[model samples]
Target: MTQLFSDMFGTIIDNTPYMKAIGAYYAGASEDGITMAMPWREDLVGDPETRVIASGVVTALLDNCCGMAVWDRINAFKAVATLDLRIDYMRPALPGHELKVTAKCYKLTRSIGFVRAFAYETSVDDPVAAAQGAFIVTALKSDATGVKS
Candidate 1:
């Protein structure tokens, strides 16, 4: 588990394009969940005057965070499809403030996983967005070498 965490938060994380594009980074990880951060970018601005980050970006951030939490909880990489994701914007994120999102896989069954997540700029209690989602879990197939794909 320790090695998995190191690999995930280390080299493997750096090579992911979407994560890189959004400036996502490992903020923290625990037995139940993982937290990721996305720094605010001028190019991602939703309103010119307010400079608040776009709601779409927040949705993406939470979605990715939730999915990662599921993988971490399962302790293995598995193919999962987002079945449903519902995000509610509580408030607009402050301009230039980095958004931190925490997500957890609360329940896992034979075919699905339930996840919940929240996003905030300064503190978790004061969330800017909250989300609840379900993912369809699938078994990953290995190649001839017998390594999980």
Candidate 2:
């Protein structure tokens, strides 16, 4: 990760109240992607009996992961918003296990970024959820980075 993205996206991740409340943190990141992990906590459970993580929490994780991946792909700090996101839940997250999600930007256009992500406790093959997302990139940061729209 470059300094600008690490500084900007890192700030966003560190400051998000929900992310903090859920105990979300970066597991790892690369120039093309990002990975995040959140421990299973009582308050985060969607079903107390099942001890499954809330779908909403998982959705937030996917969104944040996708957003961060896009920002890193852009290689600069800029205004970006989720244009669309599609998530398919494969199954309940493993009980009492921390869920990890990874996302990568696969395509970049002048105004948009396309990404894919998945959530799992152990392996991507047995995913808890998978996501395909697109984000709208504002022109503000592109000028500085020479990304012509």
Candidate 3:
């Protein structure tokens, strides 16, 4: 199947308010999967002194990354919902370091897509968090862009 990540990619991803609010941006995509980045900002610090990013921000980053990976794998613009996302925090991210997240849609069936993602600053092996999630995919109408529900 021909992979599609542009037409519907910007329409849905660029408009995500949560992604924007936390300074998350689409880094790029490769044969491996989709990648996204979040900047470390003073406003995002969980503790004023430690300056570690809030945990919720990392969760959001990984979630969006997973969704995009599913879209890239399916090679179509379809409605996808996160059925479940389990993120295991390996360690707290380094202060003042930008967090990078990459996700791969390793398996896709007619109705479900499975993804595994890692959030890290330096190396994937030394990840700040690891997530494995399943997304429920649904067919779209003729337009193929809108989420039915």
**Model 2 regions more than 4 Å off:** 1-4, 7-9, 141-149
Q: Report model 3's TM-score to 2 decimal places.
A: 0.87
Those runs of model 3 whose alpha carbons end farther than 4 Å from true positions after fitting are: 1-3, 6-11, 142-149
For model 3, residues 1-149, the per-residue Cα lDDT tens digits are 65466446555666887787887888788776788888898888887778889888899889889988988888777888888899999888899898999999999999889999999997788999999999889877444433321
- Candidate 2 per-residue lDDT, tens place, 58-145, comes to 9999998888888778878676788889999989998789999999999989988999999999888899999999888886735433
Superior by TM-score: candidate 2 or candidate 3: 3
TM values, all candidates: 0.87, 0.86, 0.87
Instruction: List, residue by residue over 33-120, the lDDT tens digit for candidate 1.
Output: 7888889999888888899998988988888788777777677777766888999999999888889998999999987889999999
RMSD of each: 4.1, 4.7, 3.4
Cα error of candidate 3 at position 146, Å: 12
Q: Distance from true position, residue 52, model 1, in Å?
A: 0.3
- Name every residue pair that clashes in candidate 3: none
Q: Estimate the overall C-alpha local distance difference test score of candidate 2.
A: 0.83
Clashing pairs for model 2 are none
For model 1, give the RMSD to the true fold: 4.1
